[model samples]
Target: MSGIYIHIPFCKQACHYCDFHFSTSMAKKDAMIAALKQELVLRKDEFKGDTIATIYFGGGTPSVLTTTEINDLIATVYSNYKVIENPEITLEANPDDLSQGKILELSQSSINRLSIGVQSFFEEDLKMMNRAHSAKEAEQSIGEATKYFDNISIDLIYGIPGMSDARWRQNIQKALSFGIPHISSYALTVEPKTALATFIKKGLIKPLDDELAQIHFQTLYDVLTKAGFDCYEVSNFGKPEFYSKNNTAYWLGEKYMGIGPSAHSYDGKNRSWNIANNPKYLKAIGEGELPNTSELLSLTDKYNEYVMTGLRTIWGVSLDRIRSGFGEKYYVYITRQMEKYLEQELLVVTYGHLIATKKGKFLVDGIASDLFMINLG
Candidate 1:
């Protein structure tokens, strides 16, 4: 089974640290929606033999669209693609857009899951991030949404420049207070060209502390695991049945089609992405063209990606699968690389899977990179 991801490339306002493609203006929303539906129609054959197991509405802010508009897109998917019965349909929303009325409307629609962007429950943090919602709105939105949807996820950011350990603990406690089943949290990283990076460079904001972020991640894992949430992936914590199927599929290397500007798609061996510019994407789709670029994956490309994604999750690299699937040389290289980490207790092989140890969880990315199949043809 595969999935389809629809990128809603419009937001009411830009967040300080975000570099995702989106327009603050709603000027072309109607046309964009039409182009999205058209793109789905144009690409349906790509998934002709695969059943769509999840339909994810990710975004700049999917909640900005009306319920009718969202349903129309779903209807288009249903009409064009082979979707599973009771597929996981997720809508990524912002707290400000999830008012009581909007929540009720969405609950009654085909959308079964809601991933709300509640970056923080602190006023100062919200102000620094330029999130459009207040602390109260973040709390209130989740409270209202819980009344309607049980499969809900909220985003939380940690390691804000001035966020203390006590404050980060408070954020976790506050989220648990709402009985949210799933939480996706990440450290605040200053991406190049984002406002956060500029502010740091200008000395208007403190640069991110990697050491602090690691502390926050450990705190997050400990607290959530104690609360009976699974650290299925480094950044995602979910209860038994609440793991995000869409994201899990991606991590597992399943095929998925991404629709809209700057969205990406991957088949078993090839990957593609749409043009990032909105006007160009719309015009190309209107003119019966797929404005995208593609690349066929080399064996090394596939191996490196698998190692990178695998080590970041509870499902570690399968040494047997690696040896069998990627060949003896790759298996040997990885096992040789594994010796040092295993000695440090940063990684371990249990039941034939190479999993990251608790101490190494925060450092998995760097470790995975070190184990990458670089300079190998």
Candidate 2:
């Protein structure tokens, strides 16, 4: 099964720590939406024979658009693409946009899952991040949303500069109390060129401590797992049936089509990304052209990608698959490289899968990097 990702590259306001491509103005919303639909119809044959299992609306904030606008896009996909009978259509929304009226409208739409951006349930944290919604809105949105939608996920952030452990725990507890099936929590990273980075540089905000972040990660894993949620990915915790289908397909290396500005697409051998500029994208699409660039993947690039994605999920890298699919040379190299991690008990070989140990889960990215084929020449 394949998936489709539609990027909505507009937000009401820029968050302090965000680096994703987006515009704060809605002046080009109509033109951008038209361009997005055109892109979908243009690339419909890319996954001609495959059935679409997931359609994800990700971005600056999909909820900013009206339900009618969203439905038009969904109808376009349905008319042009081969979709499954019951596909998981998810829309990423912010708490403030998910009012009772909005939730009611969305419930009647094609969207089956709600991925709400409830960064934190604390007003101070919301202020620090410059999120559009307040803490009360965060709580109320979920409360109102659950009445209509059962399959829902909320985003949470940890490791804010002055956020204490107790406050973090309360955040988790507050989320859990809602009986929601999925939670995607991430550390507050200060990306380059972001307002958070500038603040840190000027001492306007305290620098983030790695040790504190690590502690928060552990706390998150412990709290969620104890409540019967599976920590399927590093920052994702969900009940077995509630895991994100779109993201899981991506982690498993399944093919997907990404539409709209700054979106990406992969089809096993080649990867491409659309232009990040909104006006440029609209102009190109209006000219009946694709504003994107692509490159074919080398064997070394594919191997590293598998290693990176495999270790992050419950499905660990298969040594046998590496040996057979990538040739025995890669298998031998991996065997040798993994010896150090195995000796340190950071990784374990169970059922021929290179799964991370509990002690290594928090540092899996570093471990994966160490095992990368750097001298791929």
Candidate 3:
């Protein structure tokens, strides 16, 4: 089954460390919604024979849209695409936008899962990240949301500028206190053009310590696993059935269509992304033109992508599939590259599958890059 992702490019404010595409203005909100519906209708033929298993509302905080608006978007998807019975419809929301009343309204709507952005429950961390919610609001929103929704996930950031190991542990424990079924955590990274990078360049904030981040990742894994959550993906922990269907479909290389500005779509062999500019995207859709660029993946590109995504999950890269799908040459190259990591116990071969050890999980991305097939024309 495939999925549909709708991107909402409006946020109340910008986060210091985020470089995602979003506008702080709501002047064109109505027009943008119309464009999104039109885009879905325009692309319906792309998934003519596929059944949609997940409809994900992702973005600059999808909660910024009213429940009516969200339902309208979902309705558009239903009318245009073939959706499965009881599909997983996820809304990425922020604490500030999820008041008690809002939570109740959303629970009554067609949305079944919520991915709340509660970066941290500390006042200092919230202020540092310029999150729109306070510590109290973060806890309060989660508390209220749980009363109405069982499939919920919260985001947490580790290795923040001043976050100590003890504080990181507390953050995990606090999340556990809420009886949440899923948690998506990541180490803070300084994107080149974001305020976090600027602060470090000017000595206003200390540079990120990779070693500290590694330690924090281990702590996260240990705590969550002990609490009965599976580290199904590198940064995602869930209780068996609560894993994110939308993200899992993408990671597994299933076909998906992304609607709205700055969204991305993948159709197994080709990938495409819409324009990141809000005004330009709106104008193009208004003119009945798709403002996106696409590329057909080379054999090397497909193999490399499989390696990159496969290593980050509990499902490791398959040796037999690699040989049969790509060819024997790729299998040989990857097996040769796997020697050093295998010797170091960073990567292990289990039942013919190449999997990362716990020691290597935090470093999987770098390891995956090292194994990339390059210049194999």
Candidate 4:
């Protein structure tokens, strides 16, 4: 089954560490929504033979849009595409935007799931990250949202400069108190030209501590696992029957069409991305053109991507798949590279799949890169 990812590019305010494609100004929200609907209509035939099983509303903040605006977008999808019955629809939201009235309205809408951006339940961490919501709002939003949606996921950040182990533990405990079914947490990274990077460069804020982040990750894995959560993917934990279908589909290499500025698409061969600039995107779409660049994937590119994504999840690299799909050369190369990691107890071939061991979970990216084929014809 295929999926659709709609990127809402408007945000009420910018987070200090974010480098995502988004504009703080909502002056063009109407135009942007129209363009999004138009894009969906334009790309309806892209996934002709496949039924869309998931629809994800991700962005600067999907909650920023009114319920009517979201419903219209969904209506366009239903009108244009072959959406499956009861598709898993998700909207990424910010706590500040999830007021009780808004939550109630959304609960009545077609959106079945919500992914809240609650970075922390502590005021200092919230301020440090420049999140728009206060700690009280973070707790309150979740408290209210839970009454409406059962399939809820929240995002939390670790490795903030002054976040302590005790504080991190408290954050996890607080989330558990809400009985949230899924959690996606990540270590804070300072991207170039982001406020976090500039602050560090100017000595205004302390630099991120990688070692500390690693420690925090390990602690998180331990805590969640003990709470009966599955570390199904790196940085994602889910209780039984609550895994994110949209994310799982993407990781398993399902084809999806992304609409709106800075959105991306894959059709099993070529990958494309929309223009990141809002005005440029709108003008092009209005002129009956898609403002995007495309690339057809080569065999080498596909193989490397498979290796990268496969190693990060519980579903490890399949030796049988490698041999059948990529040829014996790639299979043999992978087995050869496995010798070193297997020796170090970092990876193990369990049931013909190369799974990362506990020792290698935090270092999966580096390990996958080491196993990548630099030159394959």
Q: Which portions of model 4 show Cα errors greater than 4 Å?
A: none
Candidate 3 residue 74 C-alpha distance from true site, Å: 0.3
Per-residue lDDT for 129-223 in model 4, tens only?
A: 88899999999999999999999999999988988888899999999999999999999999999988998999999999988898899889999
Q: Who wins the lDDT comparison?
A: 1
Q: How much RMSD separates candidate 1 from the native structure?
A: 0.6
lDDT of each: 0.95, 0.93, 0.95, 0.93
Task: Kindly list the per-residue Cα lDDT of model 1 for residues 186-291, writing each as its tens digit.
Answer: 9998888999898999999998999999999999999999999999998999999999999999999999999999999998989999999999999999999999
lDDT of 2 by residue, 1-377 (tens): 99999999999999999999899999999998999999998898888898999999999899999999999999999999889999999999999999899999999999999999998999999999999999999999999999999999999999899988999999999999999999999988989999999999999999998888888889999999999999888889999899999999999999999999999999989999999999999999999999999999998899999999999888889999999988878899999999999999989999999998777888899999988887663
Flag clash pairs in model 4: none
Q: How many backbone clashes does candidate 1 have?
A: 0
- Name every residue pair that clashes in candidate 3: none
Can you write out model 3's per-residue Cα lDDT over 1-377, one digit (the tens) per residue? 99999999999999999998999999999999999999999999999999999999999889999999999999999998899999999999999999889999999999999999999989999998899999999999999999999999999999898789999999999999999999999999999999889989999888899999999999999999999999988999999999999999988899999998999999988999999999999999999999999999999999999999999998999999899999989999999999999999999999988999999999999999999999774
Worst 10 residues of 4 by lDDT: 41-50
How high is each candidate's TM-score?
0.99, 0.99, 0.99, 0.99
